[model samples]
Target: MAWDPAVYSAFAQPRLRPALDLMARIEPADAARVVDLGCGTGNVTRLLKERWAAADVVGVDSSPEMLATARGDGGGVRYLQADAAAWAENGGAVDILFSNAALHWLGDHRTLFPRLLGRVRPGGVLAVQMPHNHYAASHAVMAEAAAAGPWSEVLSPLAARFPVGEPSFYYDLLAGGSSHLDIWETEYLHVLEGDNPVVAWTRGTALRPLMDAVDGAWATGFLAEYARRIQAAYPPRPDGRTLFPFRRLFMVARKG
Candidate 1:
């Protein structure tokens, strides 16, 4: 799915809040080098640079468009294009391998986690945060719409890939490599305004796959069906704001 920095950054503060929460949990230590994997538009990467001013922070991303915006200004931080799944090859041993809302776009965590952990030094940290809202209504309704609508025949396979696994899945997966593991989930109730805020939210992320696979007209029809379902699933408050509850998973592991 193609990412739109403008669309993704629409609710900038709400998105940035999760990255800040994850950053707060990171133990303070001497980090000579840090990397922001899948660093979209380098917003959080800039934050990482601030938190570790002494460290050589590199914001790594695959999208040229995001990197273009990222390179515009990030203090002295270096922004470059690289495959997120193979990010470790570009840089040597890193003290901190940080990724926010990016790793899920790659393949499975079963092998991905272990490979990523190998890039960290013996005492280094691997920090990640990914959307666990695939189980939420915003996603479910889109899958439902895709399966039942006129586009079902063509869009069914697009729903096959689910990038996120539950918290338990990670705890067990990383038990051997991590000495001090911090794993948790947060459900953020974002108060949003305007019509079908949920639809607007997912358009930047979840709904992109289907939209990418179809033409403008079919995509419009599919979005209409999706928006209708989501609107019903999430109603507006008296003040005309819709409360969108989004779930995300975070984990910090120190290499043993």
Candidate 2:
């Protein structure tokens, strides 16, 4: 499914916060070559260049559409269109390898972490952040909706798999090879204002598979079902704001 840059940036500040948080913890060093994996829209990618002005920074993404926007506002930062799963193969070694809110789209954390770390030079960083909200109420409803109705067969593959593993799973995968491994989880209860803000928020990220599975009309029905479930799960406050609690897992590992 194609990504809508505008929709994804609806709550830009909140989404960008995690990237900034991930960057803040990285060890300061002169990175001659830096790379931002799955860098959408280049918002956070811009920081890499700012932090290490002498470094040749590049933002890599799988989506051509996102790369288009990334290029438009990249502010001289190089943008590359490449599959994130083949990051080690397509993109060569770098002093710092960073990914914000993107690695979760690719599976197989068992080998993925090591492969990613291998792409960085010795003493370089491999920093990443991924949403760990798969088991949450909002996403649970997505799986439920995917299993029901005419669209079930088409969306089955999307429903059966998840991109992220457990927090401990990441630690186990990287601790053996990493000199410095930092793993943490954060939950942000975002207070949003609007009609079905939860629905709106999800449509940007988690709702892609269902949308790609069915026709416009069928997608509408599927969204209605999901919205109905989410509304019940997250009631609006007295001021009519929806409280969307999102959990994200982070890892900042430095190669030895």
* Residue runs of model 1 more than 4 Å from their true location after superposition: none
Please list all clashing residue pairs in model 1, or write none if there are none: none
Q: How many clashing pairs in candidate 1?
A: 0
Roughly what TM-score does model 2 have, to 2 decimal places?
A: 0.96
Name the 10 consecutive residues with the lowest summed lDDT in model 1: 84-93
Query: Cα RMSD (Å) per model?
Result: 1.3, 1.3
What TM-score against the true fold does each predicted structure earn? 0.96, 0.96
lDDT of 1 at 86: 70
Q: Which parts of model 2 have CA positions greater than 4 angstroms off?
A: none
Error of 2 at 116 (Å): 0.6
Error of 1 at 243 (Å): 0.8
Tens digit per residue, CA lDDT, model 2, 1-256: 7999999999898898889999999989889999999999999999989998999999999888888988888576998888888876657889999999998888777878889988889999999999988888888888887777678787756766677988899898899889989999999888898988888888899888678768887788777888888889888999998888999999999998
